[model samples]
Target chain A: MKLTIIGVGLIGGSIALKLREKHFVDYIYGVDYSEQHLREAKELEIIDEASPLENAVKNSDLIIVAIPVDSAKKNLESVLALINDQQTVMDVGSTKSGIVQAANLHKNRNRFVAFHPMWGTENSGPKSAISDSFTGRAGVICDKEDSAPDALKMVEQVAEHLEMNLLYMDAESHDVHTAYISHISHITSYALANTVLEKEREEDTIFQLASSGFSSTVRLAKSHPEMWVPIFRQNKENVLDVLNEHITQLRKFKSALEKDNYEYLEELIRNANKIRGILK
Target chain B: MKLTIIGVGLIGGSIALKLREKHFVDYIYGVDYSEQHLREAKELEIIDEASPLENAVKNSDLIIVAIPVDSAKKNLESVLALINDQQTVMDVGSTKSGIVQAANLHKNRNRFVAFHPMWGTENSGPKSAISDSFTGRAGVICDKEDSAPDALKMVEQVAEHLEMNLLYMDAESHDVHTAYISHISHITSYALANTVLEKEREEDTIFQLASSGFSSTVRLAKSHPEMWVPIFRQNKENVLDVLNEHITQLRKFKSALEKDNYEYLEELIRNANKIRGILK
Candidate 1:
């Protein structure tokens, strides 16, 4: 199948690499407003060719709206206006409810499938893309009943080819669960990095004594702001809910520590340790 | 040289494996309060034999205390009572100021060298031990001037044998730096894990939908609480200082998101991205 991946950054570029490597796609056309990213994607051969959005959408069997969440809604609206019943449209945005709502009224709503593959690295841009990025990860297909049967089947086939496990859920459910499990993590990490940076102004000390635990806990703080700010804005309510809960948890811990309530602190940590069973 | 490693859990067991694998020590003796861990350590050949603490200390040329921070101080106090001038002792605890102070007036203070190898994992016990665990990691030797020259030489030799870079710092400096970098990370992770668990309340959702970002950020939450509680207690002041700063940073972020201050959020993330330069 010929596939056109718009905004070929980390997720989009990785998808292009995997599809081309597996021969699931015959020709992959890339489209991005960033001229530098487009140049890098072409130079890296992540896609077969770089083309205008209209040209790529007109010719490809599949059109992937793989951009930042805010930009994704705009692109989805434009693509829905142009795509026909035969060409499948899909998006790999982290936030889904808003995008799904934006395209809900389109006559071609049945052609678009909203998805979020639960995988990513701290790095971004086309240079950071890797082959087989989505393998062994879960791909959430949201509001699939709204999509045409053929469009859903084609997207599922691609997910299967990429070795991704398909999980079905409504767009609202996807946003809520993602806020709880994914989006909040990024915010926590970013806040943590800022915390350490602000409090420990002595960079030399952080550089000297920082261990693997610190690096792992704050790893997501290095994520691209341009990509993530929109996600937090789009999924504002769910993100806020989780954020408030996180702050409350931290306050509880602080109060216990300040009061020298070792027993309470121990119980809290012991409960947190239960996450191990689920993570494994 | 013969070596005795007390408390053959994660740190001690891993050190035993590395020392034996590199042939740094001729015979490795293990001592632990847990009979099961001692048996498992012996079965895994993490030690040549499981010996009583008294016997292990009497026969070994070098003694490594790797128990929980509180137990470490207590054991060091007892060990100091029994040590001869020729027997060199060292510790691999996360915090140092308290341990150093407890051992300061001991007659064998020169024989006791305080060291903290900046390496660990979330998992614990003999099952979690791995060979070459300290390779390429920094090992901090606190108050080296207080240790006997021969004792310092033996510890430095072991660190070099494990391919570790040795750094020298005073006990107070080590405690403060570790609190800022290591202890704070664990607390943040524990709180984050609890936050998500409290809010989501669904095990299946966290397990299935959690992205790499969440897993990485909360990975340290799986750490054994028994080991961490004492570190926090020992380094309470520094930990509290960093914790307060971390909470303040979160509040700043919350206010920014509340007011739709996208520009400030973007700038903050970009600044946090500076960590990438240092980390890499």
Candidate 2:
């Protein structure tokens, strides 16, 4: 089947490459506002051709709106308007509720699937795309009941081709869970990098003494503001809820330290250790 | 040279394994409060034998106080009191200032070398120890001017055998730098883990949706409390200083999001991206 991937950056370009490798799609049409991304995606063979948005949507069997959450919401309306009942549309934005709600009022609503393959890196651009980026990860299809069976099935097939496990959830629930797990992590990393940068004036010390632990915790701070600012904006309420809880939690540590309550501090760390069982 | 390691946990066991591989030590005597650790270290061949503290110190040519910061401070004096001018004593604790100060008034203060290997993982014990753990990482020798030249020279040679880049600084400077680069990262990670654990009641949801980024940011939360509490107690002042700065940094993100200040949020993230140049 022919596929059109909007915003040929990391997520979109990776999906395009994986689908072509699995023979799930015969050709991929790349659409992006940036001409450089389009050229790089085509040169990297991530997509077969670069086409205008209208042409790409009209000529493809599947349309994947893989862009920032704010752009995805606006573009979802335009893509749904252009697609016929025969064409299936999907989006791979980090947050789902706004886009799902935007698509709800569209005439071609049933033809659109709200999907999020739970995988990402700090890096961006088509050059950072990898074919196995989503392998062994969860591919969540949010508000599945809102999409037509055929539309959902095509995305499920794409998830299978990408070697991802399928998960189903409501869009609101997906947004809340991501805010707790994924979104808050980015905030903490960005804040951590800033904390070190503000206080540690000597760059040479950080360069020499940065252990793997420090590097791992601060790695996500390298993410682009263009991507994250939109995510935090679209999921503002949920992000704020978790961010407040996170600050409270941190204050508990501060309180324990201020009072010289080593026992309470140990208890807090021991509680945090519970994540090892859940995550691994 | 014969070596006595006075704590067969992660740091001590790792150094023992690496030094054995380099043939720098013909015999290693493992001493730990936990007999199980000594047995495991012997079985894993991380140490040649398990010996009592007094016997181990008397028989060995060099002594390594590879224990928690609290224990290292108490044991440094004991080891120095037992060792002659011919024997060198060193430590591998996270903080250097407290222990260096504790040893300052000892009669054999010149025989003690304050060292820290800037490499570790959340995993602990002899089982987690690896011979190449310190390779290509920094080995810091603090307050070297206070130590006898021969004692400093022996520790420098040990760093070479471990294949680490050597850096020298005063103990107070090392403590301040680590509080920014290392200790604060752990607190953020622990607090982040607690934030998700406290807010997300559904454990399965976190397991299903936790991305690589979340895992990377919270990996240090798995660190053992026994090892961390002592370090925090000893470096309480510096840790508190950095922790306050970190909380202030996090508050900027909170304030920006609360006011819907996307421009400020973008600026915060862009500023954090500056760390990429320093770290990599």
Per-candidate clash tally: 0, 0
Which CAPRI category fits model 1? medium
Query: What lDDT is reached at residue A249 by model 1?
Result: 86
Q: Summarize candidate 2's per-residue lDDT along A118-146 as a digit string, tens digits.
A: 99998999999999999989889999998
Clashing pairs in 2: none
What are the per-residue Cα lDDT tens digits for candidate 1 across A1-280? 8999998899999988888888889898999988899999999888878899899999999999889999999888888887888999999999999999997989899999998888899888899999878888999999999999999999998898778988999999999999989988888888888887777777877786778898998888888898899999998889888888888888877887888888888998998999999989
Model 1: colliding residue pairs: none
**In model 1, where do residues sit more than 4 Å from their true spots?**
none
Question: Model 2, B190: alpha-carbon shift in Å?
Answer: 0.7
The global C-alpha lDDT for each of the candidates, from Candidate 1 onward, is: 0.88, 0.93
Q: CA shift at B119, candidate 2, in angstroms?
A: 0.9
Q: Indicate the TM-score of model 1.
A: 0.98
Summarize candidate 2's per-residue lDDT along B1-280 as a digit string, tens digits: 9999999988899999989889999999999999899999999999998999999999998999998899899888888888889999999999998999999989999999999999999999989999899999999999899999999999999999999999999999999999998999999999999999999999999998888999999999999999999998888999999889888998999999999999999999999999989997
For candidate 2, give the lDDT: 0.93
